[model samples]
Structures are given as structure tokens and as C-alpha cells.
Target: MPPHARSRIESDLPGDQAAGKPAPQQPAWPDPGLLDEVQRELLNRPALVPAEESAHLADLMAAVARREAVALQGGDCAELFEDAAPSPVHRKLEQLYDLSATLREQLGMPVVTMGRMAGQYAKPRSSDWEHTPGGEVLAVYRGDAVNAAEADAAARVPDARRLLAAHDCAAATLKVIRESWQGRADGNRVFAAHELLLLPYELPQVRADPEPYASSLHFGWIGDRTREPDGAHVALAASVRNPVGVKVGPSTTAADLVRLARILNPERRPGRLTFIARMGADRIDPLLPPLVEAVSATGIPVAWISDPMHGNTTKTGRGRKTRSVQAILDELTAFVRILRAHGAWPGGLHLEMTPEPVTECVARSADARTAALNQYRSPCDPRLNAEQAADVVDAFVALLRAA
Candidate 1:
């Protein structure tokens, strides 16, 4: 429990403490039927093969090497390889290997197959949230301003309804991409809900749209091991950057973010909303109080996702086995404790990762001990090799368990 969290929870209880009875027993774990249903649904949906399905995945390394060689050598062999597009077999095999890299790295083993989860996209007429058997299903809205404007314009023109619908469909698809998770069951599985990341973009009209064209809401009902519906939860977070010497826009302010949260979570009364704060290192200090105030204004819970792997201010030394590695870990631990002291620990975390082990974002160090730091070009960066991605996931799991 972090600061103010215990108090917040206590405040929510009725004053009749003396008359209160023991809390109800937790729900029984769900049955296997639910898990089976989920598996069937996921397998039936159209999915992309990111990695090779065959046991001989090592063969891809050779093929990639061959392709690289052809690219490097500017001779008849190179020209022939370039002129003749890679065979379908080769292309498919390459994709299979590429995608599998991260999955294998994070899981600490090889992945035989992967599939996409089917999500239920819908719009609620009223503010009433639906209850899935497990708990609450996550519902995210696609509410980018550009899409909102297009939807508004289409509303006045009857003929433009189709165009609006197209935009809505596109928005819905983006929502799915942002929030859906690829599940791996064998090890400590990673279950992600992406809606929280899209909260800033949710628009009012789109949320109310009966058949919204540009702005829409999408949700997926996820079940735990017992195959029962898991309830829905909300996390409010943002990427931060230094603005001390830069001009700040209205949209960049914490006030703007709070306003956005209010608009997106209409069902949450001012005093009942709950949120978790995930601050990036660059803007952590200045952003902290404002975030607390904004969410607290709505009486929501706010926790922090102390992502040391990405958010830590420490830079890697010349080598991975450098003496600073221990120091960096110690600093990250202290940072987590600091956040916990500020009533921001919610026992949850968010990580940007992948399923491959190649040096797609940064070259691997020649020495195993030399640390390789990634220079991300943008927020939605896919930079991790499979092994690094797995390391991040494992780190997160370890952190959670330790907390």
C-alpha cells in the first residue's frame, strides 16, 4: 500500500464499521471451459505468422545471413538475388523467424505458434458499463481529434455516412492494435490491456455514437486460468519529456490530460475514478504533483508504473558487464520506493517490448557484459530484439513479484 491509498480505500467504506460483517469470500476460480473457449476464438481469428512454425528455426539465421551477404556483395550473385524477389517460401519463413524472436526471448524458450485474440468492439448508448463474468471488460475509445472532426462533418451530410463509417472502422482497428495482447500460456504469461494508453484520444461524440464512424469503443473479455471473466480496471499514464526551455502547448499540460480523462471516463463520478500513474524519467518530478491532483480531483486511485528498464535516468556504460550495472539497479529500486512513498504504487507495470532476439534497434555488444543502450526515435518505438524484449518482460514480472 502506498501513501494515501490506504486512506482512500478506508474513506470509501460505509461509516457503520461496528455493524459490518466479514468480507465475502473471493469468487471460485473459473473452469477450463472458459479457457478452451478463449483458445478456440483466438485460433479461429485470422492471424499473422511472425515466426517460423518448423522446429528448424535455426535455418532462418542462415537465410538471413545469405540475404545480407547478397546485399553486401555487389556482383552478379548479388544482382541475381536482388533482381529475383525472395521466394514465397523464403519470405514466409523470414517473417516467421522475425516475429518469433521476441516471443522466444521473453518466454525464455521457443514458441511453436502464436495467435491474435478476438476483441468485441461496441458502443454503449448510456454511460452504463457492461459486466463480463470475470469482472469488467476493458473498453477503449478511438477519439483522435482529426477523426472526430471528420465524423462531425459526415454527420451533417447523409451521403457522407459511409465515409464516416470507414473512418470509424479504421479507428476501431487502431484501437485493437493498441490494446490487444498476444498470450503465451506455458511460462509466466503476459496479459496486457491496451485501452489505457488510448484514453487521451477518446472523444465525447465518438463515445456516444450509435454507429460511430470515426470515434468508437472496443473491448475484449479476458479470462484467467480458471476460465472466468476478469474484471475491468483502468490505468491513466503518459510519456513525459523535459519542457523547461521549450514552449508548452495547451495539450501538453497536466490540466489538459485531466480534462481528457474526465471526458473519457464519464461513468466515473468525480470522487470515484481510479487511475495509475506511469511517469517517464524526463518529466517525472514536475509531472508528479499535477498527476496526483488531477486524478485525486476525481477521487480516483493513482499508482505509478516504475519502469526502470526504460524510465531510469542511468545510461549504460561502454560494456554490459560494467561496474555501473549494480549501481543502476540500486537507483531503480530507490526510485520505485520513492514512487511508493508518494501513493503511486499499484503493483502493476507497463513495458514496451517485442518477440524477437535480433539487433533490430541497436547492435548487440561484442562482449556479453557490455551494456547496449537504445536510442528510441519515438514513443511508439519497436526497438527491442527478441532477447532484450524477453529480458524486459522477465524484469517486470520479477519486480511485481518482489513488490
Candidate 2:
């Protein structure tokens, strides 16, 4: 049997239901019974992913942590119910497939693709309400899984029905995703994933099978908002066998990281834990090294992937949410530098991207960004467009080679 994770994890973490930090911007569901219905429906549906698939993903992640392979995971920031239509789903999958082929050529190692789809229908917010320039207040624009994206109060109110709608959309999208991946001589079954938030959505899938299930999603990672050391998210991750990842933001302490490793993977397991650090370019230099050092000292192998998207995201003067590819590239460069300095493997990268042309970036002039807004169709968060993704693919390989 595996020995318990080096002690002090107990002292470092909060009580059973808590970990990481507090979950922020959760919507208040109007009716509790609707949750029960949604849970039942999800539980009754055939598992979107079988137990074996999640295990396969874990095995892949294990190889990644050992530096034998690299992970290439990305997708829409938040999938909308309508986006499940064949056109949108196929567009995204085609881009991902092309991405996989490119990475395989450049990285010269097996590329494990985890599309943030099949069920990435939910997202966490920073506020419960949005204040307009006229000093008017309205419910925040939570993802479609929580409420409609309309401007009226009635449309924004958290309706439990959206949960069921999201599930249906996710199921359909999964089917399209699988179908699209076919006929590709290059195996891309690895192109599966989800946002891994939304307790009501995930709990049914989890409770149904005590072990991890990724029928539709081969793997997933917890976002920064839900990484609280003693929170329900960690509890869910700990209870499963699927390879789990936690976003380590700027504030996460090295001590906290060690505690996380201990609590999640006490066995000194290699593939079971991944820390997707998203410290901004300015913060990566000082903040990332100590955490890598601390975790490395524990002797537990964990994949250290960089999610430069969240850390580099910003709002333009036009009130548009954007991220600079340069910022992303810069932070990733810093991440690799620190991991190597500390003698740890840099496992891979996680990005928010899409096939559509959207998002305001360095090349996207103010006029272009404003024009891109006309094409921006994401329900939540910004994603790199096809051109931007291509730029990232080439630039990332070049950067890693230089490193």
C-alpha cells in the first residue's frame, strides 16, 4: 500500500468540505427540486464516458509528468446550448484535429489532446451582479448553464432548467465531437474534456460511479475559483481516480501546494495530480519557482502545465474581454524557465481557444478588435481565434525548443 502523503496536510487544509480558497460568483438556483431532477436525469443517462477512458487519460498524463509526452488541451471558454449544432461542433473539432497534427510534427512526441468540450457548458463568475454605465444594476452574465444571456432581469435570473438544457446540449455535442474525430488517420480520441466545475452537473456522474468517469471527457481540471483547499471541488477530485488538475494562481503558496499534493495524491503518484499555474507574466518570475520547488521536494510526480490564458486576460477600454498572445507566450516562457531551474518537468499547456475569429490581441488592431466583436460569439470568456491558435501552435513549439 502507498504511504500517506508527507504529513502536515491535515494541519494545512481546511475541514473536509473545504480546500484551496472560497468558490466565488456562484449563482443562487431558484428551486432546489430542479436540481434533483437534473441529477436524476444525468444519473439515468448512459455514462457519456466509460471508466476506462478516464484511466487512459491518467496514463497519458503520467507519461507527460515523466517528460515522455506533451499535453495539448484547449476549447471554447464556455459552450452554449446552440453551439451543439453540427456546424459549430464540427468547426471546433476540425481546428483541434488540425492542431493535433501540427503539434505532433513540431513537438516530436505524442500529443495528448484534451478539448475543453463535450461538457464545458458552465463557468464561474467574479461577481453576482453587473453594474451598467447608467448606474443600473443587473444580474451578472453567468454562463448559459446558469441563465440566459439576455439583458433583462427575468432572463438573467438563475433558472434550474438551464442545467438540464446544458446537459442535453453537452450530450449532443459529445456525439458530434466523437463523429468528427473519426476518419482522422492520426488518433485523436484524446480530444475529450470539460470545464469540470458545476457541482450539480458533475456530482451525478461522480456519485453514480465512485471511480472517475470521462465517457464524454477523457479528463478535466478545476479552475482557480474552486481550488479552495477545503471546498467541494477538491472533495470531488480526491474522491475520483481520473487525473485531476488544480489551477495554482498567484496567491497560492508553496506550502499550500505541498498540502494540495499530499491531500490529493498521498501515494506519491505521478499522473494523479497536475498543477496548472496561471500566474501573470509580471508575477510568474517571483511566484512560480518556490511552488515548483516545494512540490518537487515532496517527491510526488505532478504535471506542471501553464494556463497563461486566465492570468493574462484583460478588459479593453471598449469593455471587451481580451488576452494578448504575447502575454501568454511570455508567461509560458517564464514557467518553463522556473520548472527547469528547479529540476521539474514542464508537462504541457492549457489554453482557451476556438476556430472562430474573435478576441482582441496584439495583431488585432483596435478597429479589428471592434470588428471582431461582430464575430465574437462565445457565451463566456475570450478564446484565441483560428489564426491566433495557429500563431500559438508555431510560437509555442519554437519557445519550447529554445527552452
Candidate 3:
């Protein structure tokens, strides 16, 4: 039996009440028939592992446990892989494995890897109509961050000056290239498109006035799959005045989502929708196909964002500190197979990164132990710093090129 499968069985076994020991006997590994049932539900389950990759993956895990080449700095999770040369198989795994390898090398520990998501937090709607000068925008941007009391507090500003400044600067940097190609009619659109696409993160502010920029704008939203009551939902409703692309889960029933979409886009129909289905290693086998079909019936482009790390780790009472290294690997592999079968490449990735590495999110870290991880007292932000952010970007670019 696969080590991951064995781990799943162990996790599910009942615990002893008196001695506080886990059940003594090993549960029977799923029979061949049971394995088929499980694979059938997944879009494209990987063939039984090749001997070479299996051995390599095991070696990688062991190296992580021993704290070999891994390094840990403060920044996005993907940044860890920026400097490393990825193996051919690492490309197939996309950002997850590259990141895993990086974490193992740098942190002397195994890092949990989740699937990619493509979207941004919605910008709050702006109250003003006219374009303001650069100085005014900078002041407003700084003020918003200073006043925000939550991890995403700055996300509330409808007309965020900070984002605008970034967008303007990026646009200016790309202007010469854009203008140079303007005379090439057929390819001019591509150059113009490049200018617009350079700042995909500027949506929340753009959505505040979709009409002025409607011809050149596109928007999407991102949030933690397991983190309920997302602030993005409210911000999206306020900013997404028309039907834009929406990426959601597969298990989400059709009728409910359509109704919600209708409410959000009352005057015009939304287009180019995408929904992500989460298929992890531990889910029961019978529910996969219907879940896929249900989401497909909504007439949207459906993709799967498999939660390799978080899926199995979310047990009844588990904490981040107690998560196992092997568990993270199993979940990540499951995610890769699911995405390959579903047709969408892991186009872009998202992670809970921070500028500083030793934040409160990791309980074993000093900051969290000293400060506390309570709602109001959550430690310093968990965003990736410059080097870390660059690493993640490099990893994603490598994965994209490999694909």
C-alpha cells in the first residue's frame, strides 16, 4: 500500500479512551476493487507510481525531515524555490513541488503545499469620480493601511491610492514598449494588452468604477477555500456590478450559485465563469463524478483546485504545529492528478505568504508562541518579503513554462 494511503487509514482509526492510545490493529488496506472505485471518481487519477519517481519522492521527504538544503526567509511560500534548479518531475507537479523542495532545503523542514488559485481581493468602491494626482493617491493609500486593523483591512478602500500608485508606476515602466509596438497594427493589441495585464492586482479599485474602464478591464476574486465568511464576497458584490468571471468549488450546487450570481448581475448575464472542485486524498470515492457534472451544468468553465496539504490535515482537532510532513506530500499529489484530468493547468498560484518569515501563523515559531494566535491578537502579517516573493514568482513562471 502507498505510504499516503497507510497514513490515511491511521488517521481515521479510532483512538483508545482509557489508555489514550490509538487502536492497536492496522486497518485493512483498501482492496483492488476499492482502489478502482476511488480512482474512478477523480477526473484523472495518476497511474500507479513509477518506481523512479516514487523512490525520489521518498528521498525528498527524508531529506526534508533531516533538514538538508531548505532555507526559510520571510515572504510568499513559492519564493522558497526561486533559486533552486527544479527536476523534470518538479515541473509536472507545478509550483507545489518546487515550493516543497525549497522549504525542505531552506527551513530544514517540510512545508505544506496547496494548489494554485488565480484571482485577487476585490478593491473597495471609490467615492470620488475624477482621477487624483499622485501625491493625493499616496496619502490615501498610506492612510488606508495605517487605519486597517485586520489582515485584509487595507482591502476595504474602494479607491485604494496604494494600488493606484503601483498600477501607475508599472504602467509607466511598460509605456515605452507599449508605444513602440503601437504602429504594428495586428500586434499592437498585444502590446496594449500587455500594458493592461501588468497590473492584474489592481481590481478592487477598478471595480469601483467599471464603466470608465469597462472596455479594458477584467476581474476575479480569491479567498481561502476553508476560510468561511470571506470579506471578498461583500467587496465583490459592491464592485462587480456586472457578470465577470467567478471561480468557486465543485461541490457547490448549481441552483444556489446561479441564484447568487443573478442577484449580483441583475441587468446582464455573467460570462466566462470558472468553478474549482476540491478533491483531496481522503474523500470517499462515490461523490466525484456527480460533483463535476453538477458544476459543469451551470455553463461555466470548471477547474479543480485540489487541496493536497489542507485536505487531509483538517481533522477534528488538529493544529498547524502537529501536521505531518508525509501528509502534505500525499495531498499535493492528489491535487496534481485532479487538475491534469480537469483540463486547466495550474495557471497561477496563491499562498498565505508574508514579508517576515517568523510570524504568528506558525505556532512553533517564536513570534506566535510569545504573542498568541487569537483572532484579535494574530501575530505580524504573513506576507512574503522581496526575496521570498521573487522566489514564488520564479517558481510559478517555471511551472508555467514547463506546462
lDDT of 2: 0.73
lDDT of 3: 0.29
lDDT of 1 by residue, 1-403 (tens): 1011010111111121211221111111123344233324323332221111111222211222222100000001001111122242233223333444444554344232211111111111111122333563322111221112122333212121222333343334333332323352322221112231111122211211122211221211111111111111111111110000011111235664455445333443221222223344344556555555555566433222333323332323432111122222333354445544555443322233333342323322222244454333221222343355344434543543465
How do the residues 1-403 of candidate 2 rate in per-residue lDDT, one tens digit apiece? 1121121111111122323334443566666667667767766667777787677678777888899877878888877777889898888878877887787888888877788877777777776677767777777766888888777778877776787777778778878866765775434554567756766667666523544443335677777777766766777677677788899998899888898898888877777888999999889999998889899888988998888888887766667677777787888888878887888877777888888767445443233344345566666677888888887777777777887
Q: Give residue 338's lDDT in candidate 3 (0 to 100).
A: 43
Off by over 4 Å in 3: 1-218, 222-251, 257-271, 276-289, 302-329, 339-348, 354-403
Clash count for each candidate, listed in order shown: 35, 18, 27
Candidate 1: worst 10 consecutive residues by lDDT?
Answer: 69-78
- Evaluate all candidate structures by whole-model CA lDDT and list the values in order: 0.26, 0.73, 0.29
How do the predictions measure up, each by TM-score? 0.33, 0.88, 0.34
Better of 1 and 2 by lDDT: 2
The candidate that achieves the highest TM-score relative to the unseen native structure? 2
> Candidate 3 at 357: error in angstroms?
4.5
